[model samples]
Target: MSKSILFIELNPGMESTGAKALRICKNMGILTYVVTSDKSFYDSSLGNPLNDAEKVYEHRTDLYHIIDLVEYIKKLNTTHQFRAVTSLSELYVEQAAFISKALGIKNHNYEAIKLARSKYAWRDFLRNKGYAMPKFIFIKDINGLAYVPDEIGFPCVIKPVDGAASVAVSVCDNLNELNVAYEELINYPGFGRGITLNKLAIVEEYLEGDVYSAEYVVYKHESYCLGFTDRIISGYPYFAETGAGFPAKLLNEKKSKFYIESIINIMNFDNCILHIEFIEEKNGDIQIIDLNPRLCGALIAPMIYEATGIDPIKTLIEILIGDEPNLKRTKNRYCESRYVGAQCCGKLIEVKGFQQENLKVG
Candidate 1:
């Protein structure tokens, strides 16, 4: 039987980490298969994720339905032996976990993934475990506004329970600002890609500190800290990320390593890559911001590779298939990614300092 790996969905973007994963698997002589709802996802122009895959199965509807997804995979398994199942998109993390469980493959705990994906649930878990985290409350509706404690008063952050990329994330400095933030996010379209927003939001005390993330991989219950990166965000109101640089200078290696291990022990995460964000106060106290059960999105993987010579996506694939990853550092250098958001949404007409040779537009 030929070895094969299944991807729940290939993320679409110019610098898609999912496409990188597919290429790595193909280079390793493993047959690649992708399950996506849109057949157009295979278009050659969009990084051609399908180019690396041997087969593409279209599950337009019920893609997240575990029973249906499992049935579809089983039917396909009769013809192709699927040795592992995984996903590169945050939207499909839970689905991948469930499918792996159904197939009896090694994977992160489904319950733990669920908790990690939900900000409220993750915060509650940390609080219960005596971890340092910002005070937060779950708001189910407008009526829940009364429950916001005075301590979590003005200058709090409001965001969806399950969200990414800083979409609809905002800060409220007063009651009126809080109301506006609530109204805007409550009606925000495309939350979870039309899956509905869960009608839940989290308002938490804004921790004042420098933001940084620790990227790591867990194999056989052991965690390896790949590296730490500094996160630069747009100041005030809108918390959109401006840039990120690998080998963060502000991170305390010993303290960060201890926190990452504590989180893994509490969540019992296994056989997955974790991107954990945290805040370091002026006094050096560390407080967790969020935990994701997947590779860091955008150009983070590439930046990390460029700086430390470790490919996180490739490491994840090897771990998924029960192989030890080569973690040797081949080089040491600085890598950073910066984005300049458009002031107005429109087509491009002219360009500036971003030369073709020095930078990638997307």
Candidate 2:
């Protein structure tokens, strides 16, 4: 039997972390198989990342359904000896855990994955564990929206319990705004991949101050804090990330360490990368806001590598497949990943300016 890895659904479209990982696996002679819902997603011009994959399986069942995904993988398991099961997509991280468990592969802790993905559950878990977290209330039904002001208060954030890409994430200052945000959260659909949106939402007290994401690489029993990445958020009432800077500047050394250590010790993590998002208070205190038990994203890999001379994407793939990765920093510099948006969403007509001098496109 040949050794193989069963990759769960990958981040589609432009982000190429999934593509880069598959290429590395191919180069290292690790048989790779990607299971996705839509095969054409990886078949597009930008989807060449799948070219390096040994095979791509498009399952007929809904990718959002864990049991269905597990059953599909189990059938695939009989044909290929899978050494590991993983997902590069944050939305599918928890699902990958369940599939790995069903296949009896050593992976991240399932319960911990659940806690990390569910926003309300994670905040409560951290709070119970003595970590200072933002006040939050889970609204399973629209009727619960009325309690937002009394429970979490004004100047809060209303977001889906499990959401990404800042979809339906808004800062509400009053009951009127809160109601508007709530309706948007409810009307907003899921990933459109056949999975029904959870519809459950969370109204959380908006933590004040700057936000940063810290990546920790957990291999064996020790976790190496990769570095902190600062974020450039868009002008609000709404919270959508615009850009990120590596090695957060003006970081409160004591509070940052305190928060980072809290994350490492509090979560039930294993041999996987933990992408924890946190807010640094003006009073020099830190509060963890979001947690994703996986590598940050596609663009983050190159940014981190250029900034510190370490390839976290490769490191993530190696560790997930039960292999040791070289985690040596050979460069000391600053790298950033920027997200450019336009007035309207449409096809990429032309993107220029990379030809300019003094700009290292990573």
Candidate 3:
């Protein structure tokens, strides 16, 4: 029987990763399929995986409705059997876990994925494991603002319990700022249609340290830290990420391998790729900030591959199909990525500098 893999959603911005995965599966003679509401699935002009996939399934239902998505996949499976399930997006990681479970395919722990997706839950899990973490509280609504503890006092961070791409994440130094940030978050417009938003937010003590991400892959209970990346975020009260460079300077010194390994072992993450964010204090303390149970989004994957010839996206596809990935590095180089956001609300007037052959616009 021919094998097939189901991608829950080809997350926007990471279309290159999804397309590459589909192409790899096709080259291996395995069928490729995608289920997404993204209009790009039908418009090749915007770069669609449909060009590489055997079929494209459309579902407008919210990803939070796991049962509906699972049932939808089950119906699709009656015609096309899927051996494994995966997603390139963090927003649908939980849904992909449930669908994989429903299809009896190998996947990350569903409960673990749920906890990893929530900053509050993951912090609690790490605390329970005796790991040092920032003091935090869960806020359901504005009224819960009173519960923000004194110890987690001024200069704390506030972010949605379930969020991605640093959306709706902010830092407040006082009660007034906290209140204003809370109000703004509740009305944040980025939450997509049909998807249920987590009204709850995590208010935690802010840590003073340099930020970095440890990227790793877990297969059959064994974890391997591919490397680390130095995350450069916008200055001050806002924690918007600007760009990242790899391999992280600390990784070059080889001091972080033990800590990264310990974190993965304690978390017991399996059959998945993970991107863990942490703070490195000047005093040599490392505290985890976020644990993402999916491939590192943005250009991190390609950046890693450019630095070290091991392709994480391809390895993830291999794991999905029950194959051991060759994580060996065949080359070494330095890579970095930056995001260019519009400085003002205006139309494009002129372009410059991108005409160079060595530069890529997007």
lDDT of each: 0.80, 0.79, 0.80
lDDT of 3 by residue, 246-343 (tens): 98876233556677677777777788899988888886667778889889877888899999999999899888888899899998899989987686
CA shift of 158, model 3, Å: 0.1
Tens digits of per-residue lDDT for model 2 on 1-362? 55688787677654567777887788878899988777665556654566567988887434356687788789989899789888787777788788888888875578788888888888888789787667888899889888887888889998888887678899989998888888888888667545445889988898788988888888876778878888889988887788999877644766677667656666768788888887887777777778888788746678898888988888987887677878989999997777777878788878678777555554
In angstroms, give how far residue 44 of model 2 lies from its true place: 3.0
lDDT of 1 by residue, 67-107 (tens): 87788888887787788887888778777787777777766
Model 1 alpha-carbon miss at residue 168, Å = 1.8
Worst 10 residues of 3 by lDDT: 39-48
| Residue 67 C-alpha lDDT in model 3 | 73
How far in Å is the alpha carbon of 21 misplaced in model 2? 0.8
Residue pairs that clash (backbone atoms under 3 angstroms), model 3: none
Q: Go through the candidates in order and give the clash count of each.
A: 0, 0, 0
Which segments of model 2 are wrong by more than 4 Å? Answer: 60-64, 345-352, 357-362
RMSD of each: 2.2, 2.1, 2.3
Model 2 TM-score? 0.93
Question: Model 1 clash pairs?
Answer: none
